[model samples]
Target chain A: MDEFSFINSIKQHSYKQSSLIKGIGDDAAVIRQPTQDIVCAVDTLVEGVHFSRQTMEPWHIGYRALAANVSDLAAMGASPAFYLVSIVIPKTWSSGEINQIYVGMKQLATKFRMDLIGGDTVSGQELSVSITVIGYVERNKARYRSLAKEGDKVFVTGTLGDSQAGFHILTNPGYYTDEVYYKERHQQPLPRVDFASKTENISRIVFNDISDGIANEANEIAEASKVSLILYEKQLPIKDSYEQFPPKLQHKWKLFGGEDFELLGTVSNKDWNELQIIAKETNTPLKEIGYVDDSQSNIGQVFLHENKQTYRLQKKGYTHLK
Target chain B: MDEFSFINSIKQHSYKQSSLIKGIGDDAAVIRQPTQDIVCAVDTLVEGVHFSRQTMEPWHIGYRALAANVSDLAAMGASPAFYLVSIVIPKTWSSGEINQIYVGMKQLATKFRMDLIGGDTVSGQELSVSITVIGYVERNKARYRSLAKEGDKVFVTGTLGDSQAGFHILTNPGYYTDEVYYKERHQQPLPRVDFASKTENISRIVFNDISDGIANEANEIAEASKVSLILYEKQLPIKDSYEQFPPKLQHKWKLFGGEDFELLGTVSNKDWNELQIIAKETNTPLKEIGYVDDSQSNIGQVFLHENKQTYRLQKKGYTHLK
Candidate 1:
């Protein structure tokens, strides 16, 4: 297909949004300016670096790419509004495969009513999809990593290491008995947008999304906040099936594996119970993983406590530049 | 450098904007939302496709990518407010090269006070830069390709074929005498944001930025606006230097060459002189190239008149896909 036809085909996926005054037919998409504070983030998934052709279909790649950006907005307790995608396609991809990609994004975008407004489609040797999402948040209510304080309790939504475990299962199919659950997790890990919106009532919180594992994410919050975090290894929530793998392999996945798409952060001790109540009402898994401490090495550290032994969690995960 | 440190280094490029509440240190960039109607667009440039390493430097590549997106905003008569760049780096690119890229973007961004907000940095096999820019335009005042009508005078800003001539000079050095002028045009083709802003007071006009030469852009307006355009060949504006090339090459560059970064569209006859005055006051070259016509095919036709011979202009230029 020509570029114009490709663009016109994707327009079929765009749903009517009151805020958008102009869409595909214009030089640029025009929208009624928003009045609420808005947060925007971009995430790109590249072939080989992010996903393998052996493991992922075009549909899931699209879904995962959009979800990654939405997860960032969710970390700030924002509601998704609009998105634009810039995709590089290799000639090896079929036209049908590309159409499936848009269908996949449309499925996830409809969950939050995100309107696709603009994008760039170009040919390249490798496929890469970069999506930018814009979402609304209340001015002072938006959360940030630097907002965490000494007395706050660290919390995590959903189970840790689930996506990595799922990815492992996808790569090594028959080795895991429960392939369905793990494979689905790998394919369509949901962004906690609803959970974020539910917690918007809280006056203050420090939030980060579990994109590059707790080790890296925790370090980000700790470094940005200029405080330290301590996690009880026994408190980490993981699926029981993790025990089937070798012990070191099992342990490493939870602490260092990435792409969980779950929310991780700190909240006031008094507000902790209310958060759990909201999680329970919404049926989202919630766990108290650790606490922020001023007594620890204060220039931003993360320590893990297991079997009466404590050690610093290595500050690394899924870095593109090293 | 690790991802966090790499992100930290890019922090130096982020300038402060009153609308931006958070920048490099946050999970997502947050901004005090705009109050006027806003328009956004994205453009991507892939290595070997948009530029050649032998001809263009890293700095000019960055400038060209961002300028492409700003030109879209300019076409809509929007004032640029914010921009985000998602760049992919190949293993061959050094850190200093990447820093130079951002420096190139910052030079043009500072011209219109565009702020860098949020983006993704990832590793890939080929270098690609995708830039998204958001701009403010008054409600119902923004221009569109689908707004031209019969009897509207077709106009073009700046000169045509200048970028193509410059690009040729760069690739085939000693053949062209005016290297400085054409080379600058190819390296830093300015977006018509200023001219667009000056003409924002006009009640009606159709505008399309000529990134894909006038043939493609004029055809786009004709197709989108459901009209026809007839250009007088003698009225086409070009530098006297173009005659140094072969006659066919000279003619082809003006009609089919891309990357001029000029503006082309139609204006009402009564409003025509005012546009010329504005262009003159701003020292921007303006020319009346053609007129919208109802006598031709209503299904969007473009025709060129030369030496008592009139023929159709091909509907193609610089498309990434077949």
Candidate 2:
């Protein structure tokens, strides 16, 4: 697939967002002049660190890069306008494969009304894609990791550990051939960019896209904000089949295994009710898994069911170097 | 080096520009509301395609990625602000080596007040880096590739083939060991970001960053704007030492060797005197290489000698895929 051909195929069907004054094929893509504050985020995915070449498809890789960046915009309480994608391809990867990745990326871009703006392509030793997404939020509406205060309630969008479970199913498809729900959930995880935009009532919140598992990102938010996060053992949401795994590994995978691409956010107790109402209107479950506290002043320790029991969260969130 | 460590090292010396509201350690770097239009551009460098892995230093690699993107923003007549870098490193490269790369990036970022903001780190099969730089320009003053009108005089900043000549010396250090000027030119290229901002009387201009050599980018401007560009071959700024190479290889390298990262742009004939004045003030030479014309409707065919023996210019510029 020629680069232009792949890009053209993507432009064939897209959401017509007015924010992109110039999208793709220029020195830079121009956006509608920012009326309010603009928020931008960037993320990169490489072959081994982010995805296993043996198990992941090009389309999944492409879709995840776009979905992942969009999730950051969502977490910021911004609407995505356009994204710049820089892709480096290895000789081993066919242009057709790269085109499939673009197809996946375009699908997400269209759904999010995020135009694929300008980017660069260079020959590399392995397949790597980096994307910078630009979005906009009303002035002062952006949620940041530093915004969480003591007593803020923690909430999560969508099901966690599903992507990790999906990875297992993807690698060992025969293990769950009889269970279609298990396979589908693992293969196609949704990014809640649209849903999160509706939660405007959750004011003065802090959030992160749950890429490095829920518990790991929770620790980051806490540590970065200089507060402590406590997740109740029973309040944690888990799929029924999640219990079938070896208990330690299952918890480890859910807590640290990444690529979930969900959103973990905090809001005041007053706003938490509004968030629940918003989630209900969309027919999606919003789970309250934890809360922030000023007392401990450390991050990522879970409160256990046994009285006064606690578990130290590992610093083993996905490190790019590792 | 650990990704965070390298990022911190770079951040320590990075200058904070007045336009940058936030830099590093965030989902994205935030820019203070620009008082003018923001011009943005991105560029990538790969180990094999853009530079030789065996010859180029890690710091040089880092520098070029940032420099090339800065050149693009400069071509649009924008002032550099902060930049977001995306890097992929091979596992074989040592941490110290990667740290030096960040150090090199830090040097240039400090020089230009372009903070090294959020980026990605991943283990890839080879080294690759991509940078997106955002800058500010008054909306009406922004230069574009489509703004060149017939009779516009094409001007180039600095000498062109020096980088190509420098590359040859880099690959074969023993070939011209005594010539420090030639060797240094190849190892370090200065992006003309300063030129675009300071040059006056360049309104409604068309230009591009000459990363892919001037001849090739000249063709791109011609193609994009649907205008014919005529080169005054006698005015070609061939360096004296470059004459030592076989005339064919030397000319080929000058025409096709990439990574020059200079500015090739056009302005009205009336601005020629003003350009010369600015060039003298800045101690940088601006040469009149050619002009845009509707008569020929072909790019780069011109008289080779003062006597006017015209020859066809080949579009033998560097192409990544080719």
Q: Clash totals for all models, in order?
A: 0, 1
- Residue range B240-296, candidate 2, lDDT tens digits: 667776777676766666567777778888887777777787677688888888665
- Please tell me how candidate 2 rates in CAPRI terms: incorrect
Cα error of candidate 1 at position A309, Å:
1.5
Question: What is candidate 2's lDDT per residue for A207-226, written digit by digit as tens?
Answer: 68777777667776776677
Worst ten-residue run, lDDT, model 1 chain B? B21-30
lDDT of 1 by residue, A209-310 (tens): 888888978887887788889889899988877677778867777887878888889999989988988898888999999999877545588888877877
Off by over 4 Å in 1: A1-34, A317-322, B1-34, B317-322
Give the per-residue Cα lDDT of candidate 1 at A217.
84
* DockQ for candidate 1, C-alpha atoms: 0.20
- TM-score of every model? 0.87, 0.84
lDDT of 1 at B108: 90
